[model samples]
Target: MAMKAIDPQYTADTKYALEVRNVDIYYSAFRAVKNCSFGMERNKITALIGPSGCGKSTVLRSLNRMNDLIAGARTEGEVLYRGQNLYDPDIDAVQVRRSIGMVFQKANPFPKSIYDNIAYGPRVNGWKGSKAEMDELVERALRGAVLWDEVKDDLKKSGLAISGGQQQRLCIARALAVEPEVILMDEPCSALDPISTLKIEELMFELRQRYSIVIVTHNMQQAARASDNTVFFLMDKEDRAGQIVEYGPTEQIFQSPKDERTEQYISGRFG
Candidate 1:
């Protein structure tokens, strides 16, 4: 299939809140991502679509430097956040992760209480507010995730005690409490039921006014329904590496994608 994102001169706007430029990733000697690039508009949701192992999740993890946790995983090229390249030697990956938070496919919360889960980031970063202030922030975060009413009475309950969907929302609340400028989610709704997925989708809409969101999903309908833009990924010739094939407005990409691979993937013919 024709790869539409290959034009090397195609530079996305820095006015965008986030930018991925010719990014390549590797695990030890094996390359897993090859020259993927895209730009994300401020406070908008951008969906990454591809088959499993097509580097969608890898790209998402690279954004906040999660891949760095692995001993042999390394990335080539730079991820620019608000004009600054995140991979620069001078940049602190920790700060980068804080500015851009992440959510995973499975809902994973600490064994700690719900209150502690929401307060974890802020506390670690030194949030020294009065009890009333912390309480308000926690409530706001829970409400933002649309979980306050259900768990408000049980703030002391372990976050793991909640249902899968509720736990996912709680994870979202924890990410929000840090007041990040960008949030990355990897297949967040894959394990959720229809009702719960709708809530998360609705939450994405509500969040766009304040936070830039990037999501990786195999769900074409969810990507088309929830995101303003989409990036379609594909495997390299050897099938050992993945790369972006196309990126554009969601309507354009889904309805009239410039790349044949994108069309095939979105139309359920392939992924």
Candidate 2:
């Protein structure tokens, strides 16, 4: 039997770094995801896991209003940041994005030199500081991404000149440079080698101390190993809209899921 939609719990008693409440995402009249709600704990990593086209990425993008860039994309209900609705007409999407930065599935670095790439966000956001201060900030951002030691001597090199893994880390560094409160990653490790993936996972653990994280991933083991909380999404043939079936602490979601569909998917019986 298929599972019904999870109730939209406000969870007002516990403070959340970010909250998606009773949201329905759509492209034109076609709904992609239906009535999703969850709260992200501060300084914790939350992973959204589901099959392809099940709207895990769609939900992730909605956190910062990234979906607004798409043609005909719209959302119903609220996506709250620090208890404020992001979709409120008074809110600026650019400001929202600045507060909650994103790293894509693929490594996308600018055509500029590595140093400039790291400094770009601060410059665009108007950092009122001296050259020395900007330089220190760049170095700090790179070091936070665990890439400073490797690229410090070659600051002038194009960000694209690096290997794939290094490029991905550079993107992470670039996102960090903005000093955002929450970082949304869309399958960040999907394109990396095993070693690179491990390094990224480890970096995530360290990053959670300073920033909240929400990641969309198809890798079950990655979600189980890297996330503090996990959300499971599924779509049935009768209704194409992706629905979140279960969500909870990572260990319980993996060890003993509340929904049979969640159990089946996590157990490798089906995706």
How do the predictions measure up, each by TM-score?
Answer: 0.93, 0.94
Alpha-carbon error at 115 in model 2, in Å? Answer: 0.6
| lDDT for each residue of candidate 2 in 159-267, tens digit (9 for 90 to 100) | 9999889999999999999999899999999999999999999999999999999999989999999999999998756769998999999999999999999999999
Best candidate according to lDDT = 2
TM-score, cand. 2:
0.94
Model 1: clashing residue pairs? none
RMSD in angstroms, candidate 2? 6.5
Local error of candidate 2 at residue 269 (angstroms): 1.4
Q: On residues 1-271, what C-alpha lDDT tens digit does candidate 1 reach at each position?
A: 3322222243456558789999999999988999988998898999998988888898999999999999999999989876678887667677888889999999999999999999999999888999999999999999999999999999999999989999999999999999988999999999999999999999999999999999998788999999999988888877579988889999999999998888888889975
Which pairs clash in model 2? none
lDDT of each: 0.90, 0.91
Clashes of each: 0, 0
What C-alpha lDDT does candidate 1 achieve relative to the native structure? 0.90
Give the residue spans of candidate 1 off by over 4 A: 1-13
